[model samples]
Target: MQGLQQFFTNISQFFEFLVVYYSIILGFCALISVLVLGIIMFLRKTVLADRVFAKAASWGLLILCLFCGKLKLIFETKAGWYTLGRWDLLCAHRIVSIIYIVGIFIFAAYFIYRRRRLHKFVKGLDKATTCSFDNEIRKYPGTISPFCIGCIHPIIVIPEKLDVQNALIVIKHEETHIKLGHLWIIAGYDMVRCLLWPNVFLHIAAKYIKRDLEDVCDAVTMQMNGIDPFDYGESLLANAKEIMLSRKNMKCEEGFLFAWDDNYKVLNKRIHRILERNGYDRKVVLAGGILFIMALIASIFGIKCFSYKRNNPLDISGIYSMTKMDTVVQDTEEKIVTGYDGDYIYIDGAALKEAYPDAEIEEQPLFVFVGGYYKIPGVGGGGGWGEFSASDVKDGVFRIENHDDIDVWNWMIMWL
Candidate 1:
């Protein structure tokens, strides 16, 4: 439980990181997810035979959404537009962190309860000697028909009744799911739903991704043995009906992937596709796989960076007091009206006007931007000029970092 608590805490921290640094990107992440899912929906049929490609594409999108904030850190373009985390709202961000931590804890408890209950329910499936498939296969007397569960040691649970032919077809369908790695793929979808529960489009995409997984299973199942496509379609409709009726009483929730779904629309599509029984070309599947891979790469090199280059990023246009004074100087109590000439930050309008002599350089508000180095006259913190980026000033206070570095800076500035 403590380890799980730590897991959720880390997740909560990632959540706060996005809110603090990339709030706009956080809002648009959902839209990006929906757009890619739509792309997958369109091209699902062309590459129906290759199950790995579908799963890879789905995982790529999920990873991109979850780690977009981190991407800014990894990529060269750092997050510039921080919506919050100012001195005032920094405290509020901590509060928001606590709130979502509570949310995560509540969901964690609820998921734990469901999992424990599911474990007890699964444990009751007394290995009935109906299907002689394998040792991993567990026979359940429960109403929920055959479904595949687990990533490592995937179990195919066959329920009590069904004709021999239909039963074998059902086993083949689920077996195809296991071999095609659909169980882990569904787990990916569930993670997306669990972490980003607010996104309605993602939940809708889950239904489609799950349907595509089923389609892959169907495509592979027909090729394994000489089962008639019509028979396979009939079995799908029958199993879907059984699962629908069974779901009314007991449904496969939490961890398992139902072999057949009950959605009428998706179910109809699956049945029709099975009737068509089209063949997929190796070159097309290969091309589609490359497309998904390129899309993932594009996300890294393209859409992942949400920040733009800014010469004068920070908007510290108000009066500022010298918060730190390490050197001997006068006028320490004066609040300097800072200004900038484009990217060149300067202070003391009269002093600047005196320096120019020609009066060509006008005094603009000190645009406390990033990466701007300027000679701040009459700054109480130093004797002559202090070489400090305006980025160091938070909430109009220049924080003293590393007293040793300050000593070196003061010595060097005195020479200039």
Candidate 2:
């Protein structure tokens, strides 16, 4: 029970850090992805470049954000330089983190339930060996469009009434998704979505990532099979029509569906790209390349600008008498010792220093760093350091104005 409690405590702390610092990480990712997409779109003639670059930028930024989050967790420090000390912001962070964690649990349950249903459905269906590729192809009875499902052992499913040629194309497309490991990408994205449930920017980025994955699969399928782009577009349109008609009669369950051109606008964009496989002007490419480089540099600068730092340092050492305020009772006193050693300032012995070995310490001239929260007997404990000034000290008595951002008490030196 103690071990489990400790595990949860650690997890809670990590989530708190994420809630405090995620904005900076996500802002950088969003900025970089948007700039990269905009530059690619402007270049115009590079369809392949657009597809490749979009995939890279979207996935790359997400991975980078996850990496940054892990680093923050390991370091136990918020990444942004500025801490928004507003009470409302702190409350919001706590609330949002709670919601996100709950949402992940709910999503996981739903996902597992849906996957079980899908497996049962697959089991009942008649598996056929119609395609040249040795993949499990199952005919689904409903009017749903063809989609590839499952990550580890992917299976292609097609509607029963679809014609032979279109079925082949659908199978080919889904096989392309499976072959290129798009299902795993989508699974990874879903997990990210769950983690960043409150971030609208990340949701938008996810849509773009999904769209690029589909486009890449389409491009690869056409090239590998020597199929006509026009034909593929027609097949997609027919599939979309069938799916729309089917949806009128029944509701589709929520799960991973690698449906080709899930959104109409995205479908249109895919069709346009397929129809126009032209090259861009060299001058435009050159201009875009320069802009891309500039965006990269700007992204780096933005990350550094927002990153957190402990710049303030204070010289604090000695045994002091602490005072605590109470509404009904009188103030209370307790003896505490503070000592500075290397990067960490040990308080009331060295337990904190031992626990958080990599803790960043900064000394502000007038404030004594309490690290995180500290409990003063008969007083209260909060999550920030305490503040005091030179003038606050008189006759060997140092008044600790505010501890952990709370208006509390004073301390007098008892021993060195």
- Give the candidate number with the greatest lDDT: 2
- In candidate 2, what are the lDDT values of residues 1-416, reduced to their tens digit? 99899778866654454443444333333333444445544443355456443443435345434433212222233532233122124334456545545666776777678777877777677775567465788887667767767887788888888899998888889998888778887888777665545545555656666667777777778877778888988998888877666555444441125333356776777788777754334465458657766776676556545433222122222221222121111111222323333333323313322332222231223334443221111111222344433233333223343333322221111010
* Candidate number of the best TM-score: 1
- lDDT scores for all predictions? 0.52, 0.53
Clash pairs for candidate 1: 338-366, 339-365, 339-366
Q: Model 1's lDDT to the true fold? A: 0.52
Segments in model 1 whose C-alpha atoms lie over 4 Å from true places: 1-62, 70-94, 108-113, 130-135, 241-265, 303-416
lDDT of 1 at 207: 65
lDDT of 1 by residue, 108-206 (tens): 576557656755666667765556454266666545567767677766677667667777898888888887777776766666665555467666766
